[model samples]
Target: MNERVTPEPQRRRRRPTKQGIVLSQQLIIDTALRLVGQQGAGALTVRRLGISLGADPSAVYRYFRSTDDLLLAIADELIGRAQQGWQPTGDWRADLRAIGLRIHANYQAHPQAAMLAAHRTTGRTHEIAAVEAILGILRTAGFPGPEAVRIYHAFVDQSLGFAALDAAALALPAAARTADLQVWQASYARLDAATHPHITATAHLLATDMRRSGYPYALDLLLDAAEARLRAAG
Candidate 1:
């Protein structure tokens, strides 16, 4: 007996409405990002997106079968934005550092988008290209294949993991963010040396430095360890 095969779903083609506005995939994704940026992640619903785009909510379904599909596209767009105009210098370590920082900065700029895309995999063009680019950097660095793959995995994972975390913090309300900063200044800074000796010892530095993002320092540490590994392999 022959088995019947299920037909693949066809993609919907978009056309101009009576209102004379044409909706493209890029417009939908860009509008979604702007909506999140302006009103926070909670504001991203099909209705709100349609309102922002000045179209009917059902129009979105033409391009994206579901909200999840739209979000994945938005995630890929963030990756695309990060890679724009980024050139890799020949120095492997330097190139890795630059790419990592670029990715982090783009995600930081769109914290709400970053949070939405954090755990999800787009498996789209931009993301695939980024993976290839990073792996190529490792291969060019003279690390053996297995070692290069391991390092690449760690580098990308650490970068995205931190980006997600920092994005969450960035997405906090204005008052909440202020309160977090004030905690380090007013609360941690005021701790008694005798009570919390370690924190109190670094209290001055904490009040001054803790307010700044530490991802750069963390990246340096990872690179430093990788360099040490390269030296040991020599």
Candidate 2:
């Protein structure tokens, strides 16, 4: 004797539009990235996303449970992009520096996208892979498991923290960005040695360096500190 099997009903999902663009999680994430790149993070609401996708606002909920979920996806996307084509050299410091710079550049490329989610730990595949890579670099550099984890935490946190700060500046309106640029030249450059000797002495360096992301130099400093600790423990 055979028993009849009952099929489970599926949840209702928004259908694709007349133009034939399917509504998938990747589509939503890509659309969200485009929205962020073009209009900044403030434009990433469900209504706005739906309008961008030409679907109902609820359609996005089918993929991401909330805005936070969408942001995490975006963050993972950023990490995946950064890690693309990355090759590791035997020199752990150089390899790690390359990764740090790539991550920083990726964030700068999509300033609003970074601002949306750089600080959060997405715990997704890409994020986990990045964490593993960094930890591996530290471990290869002779740091023990606990030491590697500690350095990895500091390295990643500091990198993303700088990325967020720099992205915030980049995400500013054109006029504001220009005004900020002008300040280093106009204000700092003009300061007399008597009033602000340090500023006067390093005004040129400040003007040149402040206009760019300082992540590379900062990463070097961080790597140096970690190296010192590693040597001290030996």
lDDT of 1 by residue, 1-234 (tens): 012222235323356644556777898899899998888877778889878777877767767767778888999999889899999888889988998899899999999889989677899999999989988988888788998889988888888888998999889988998898889878987888889999988888888786777888889898998888888988
TM-score of each: 0.89, 0.89
Runs off by more than 4 Å, candidate 1: 1-20
For model 2, name the residue pairs that clash.
none
lDDT tens readout by residue for model 2, 122-231: 89999999988888888888999998988888888888999999999988989999999989999999988998999999999999988887788889999899879988
Estimate the lDDT of model 2.
0.85
Error of 2 at 227 (Å): 2.4
Identify the runs in model 2 with alpha carbons over 4 angstroms from their true place: 1-15
Instruction: Please name the candidate that would achieve the greatest lDDT relative to the true structure.
Output: 2
